[model samples]
Target chain A: MKIGAALCVLLLSVIAVHAAEIATADRKSGFEFMGRDTQAMQTDDTSNPGMLNVLDGGALWERPEGADKKACASCHGDASQRMKGVAARYPAFDATAGQVVDLGQRINLCRRDHQKAPELAYESRDLLALSAFVARQSRGQPIAIADDARSANALMQGRKLFNERMGQLNLSCAICHDDNWGQKLGGTSIPQGHPNGYPLYRLEWQAMGSLQRRLRNCMIGMRAEPFSYGSSEFIALELFLMQRAQGMAMESPAVRP
Target chain B: MPFKVEGDAIQRSLTGQPGDPTEGRRIVISRQTGLCLLCHSGPFPDERFQGTLAPSLAGAGTRWTLGQLRLRLVDGRRLNPDTIMPSYYVLDGVVRVAPSFAAKTILNAAQIEDVVAFLSTLRD
Candidate 1:
């Protein structure tokens, strides 16, 4: 009887070990999605047609939008200066709000406080262009989010969210994107969810948008409850993504698909 | 080039033309575009690198009817919605939003039809 019990315990332990191994293998790796890592090609060419949107975004930046008769240009003249390194600093901790905020929320707050304009909806083009222009300021700068107590706590939550499998497919983003990245899923190859060249023109979306919008889309694809626009979960995930692409340069107003 | 024969014929057949399986097999196995072998195993026994994700298509025809196979190609996720497999052909029901990916199917309707024809001929 004791022998049988011992064998049962051994078998259970083996199964547990096997399951853990699979789970560990399913997590996403930070480097697997880099364009340079996949194939050395000119991912960001100046001649690409997508650059036109950035120019349009620049125009919109100076256009007045609020009841206060103000524009983004009203307070921060030439974002090229005031917003330098702003993108790298985003998905940052907000002390008064006591939470993390995305670039969009910050813009909205600025619009409300200074320009007296109502907030734009999440994923709106004006917001996208404005954020893209702002992110452009930090071009080539490595993302530098602080790892203070608040951010550390946020990152841990984001990691749990990334690792946890919540979709109807019973697959985490880590499973295909992280584990099976180089491999094919369906007919298409799964690219890493890096934000290096965001506000990108994805052939799939056929438009320019933010990394937070992409994250929301992924959550929907996974059948999970997508975080509200500029939610802490979204900000935390953005922070995690920025850290993942820490050394990679920003590719705002990027093209995709 | 030879693989394209089956693909061309199958496309023609779907649009009402002739397709050759031998040529179709050649194209499906090639590296450039129809790298089907990267994800599925087939009768190309000499081809050593078989992907680990899905079951081999070598005798897939023997197990599943053509209609079932067609559905898998159309959108494997529909029958098994949890499937990571992307739909190769079927139109109509697709996510129509930000990025319009409707036209970028790896296999057009004709290509999928030709591949299916090639699979049918693999009953050895």
Candidate 2:
């Protein structure tokens, strides 16, 4: 009986440690925190405003452009087949660029390298549209960020940045999202900072936006200088977020209040 | 002139003038200025929203002396290094401050005194 009690305490301690590391069972998507109306908007394609960007992106995929006069479909055939589950493995290390790149950057890289076209400006309508369209293909797929040696350093930096105190507020991402998630902060419930939803529509912005834009908004709210768009720091952070959110289902083009 | 800290408290008033509790309450509840309600709930009945991130401001006077409250407003980090509360009257050691807020503290000395005064009134 004494040994059984000791073993029970030991098992409880182990469970506590695992929970501290973010147990898979405890993971909840930002979608779970939304109201019924917003959830409905994300569910139906016709009612979702983000579908408009996906539609525009579908059109852009067939239209030819650049010096090569090639559309994305010319090389990849159909996005439904070629792009499915593609977003799940993104924020990966790019060998040619010799660094990590997110889905948006990957699209620009393809335009520059394969189609011989100029890169689209960050946060532009066409870029967001194309990204939203591609991400829509992987709506139900789980995130699977690769954890090879090539991306190990970037991943470490991302983890560090997430915990580091910044801005005049001196708040880290972990302080609010990790410690105080589900708690009310001035009438809104704080959410676990997940990256599964990107190129999604925000009610606050009233338009489609990328993960980078959202990160910048948080940094400004913290009163910290935001890292420039397309900076390696942002990519590294994205890489870290994707890895942290590993195995969670993708909800790109998601709706958030 | 720099304010002096003795132990965990500031003995002297920051602006060397008695703070009006009425003005202090205004600053504590204002979103554009103090932002206290963003992370703290206080005794403001008219305010529809209050934060749940920190201790309630109700009965703060019963909890600590006025000098201690003053130190907390000035720089709570001096007491607790891991606190999420901003050092309202501190400027040095902060990084990447936006251009408009570069050299400024979150609250002025007068405002800090006002908040302290308002907080002191919550004894109950």
Best candidate, DockQ: 2
lDDT of each residue in A1-257, candidate 1, tens digit only:
85775566567556533432123334333324445522222144465445666777788889998888887888789888987778887777777667778788888888887888888888887777777788777766766776677778888877766665653333466655555566654445576666666666665676777777788788665445667777777777877777665656666655555
Query: Per-residue alpha-carbon lDDT of model 2 for A1-257, expressed as tens digits?
Result: 85775566567556533433355787788999999999999889898899999999999999888999999999999899999999989998899988888898999999999899999989999999999999999989999997689999989999888877889888878877776788778767888889998889999999999999999999999999999999888988899888888999999889998
Every candidate's CA RMSD: 11.0, 5.9
TM-score of 2: 0.93
lDDT of 1 by residue, B1-124 (tens): 1122221121223434434566668767875446666567777767767665567777776876655565666556444444545555544333322232333555666676676677776664
- Local error of candidate 1 at residue A172 (angstroms): 0.6
C-alpha lDDT (0 to 100) for residue B80 of candidate 1: 43
lDDT of 1 at A246: 62
Q: Is model 1 an incorrect, acceptable, medium or high docking prediction? A: incorrect
Among the candidates, what TM-score does chain A have in each? 0.78, 0.91
Model 2: TM-score, first chain: 0.91
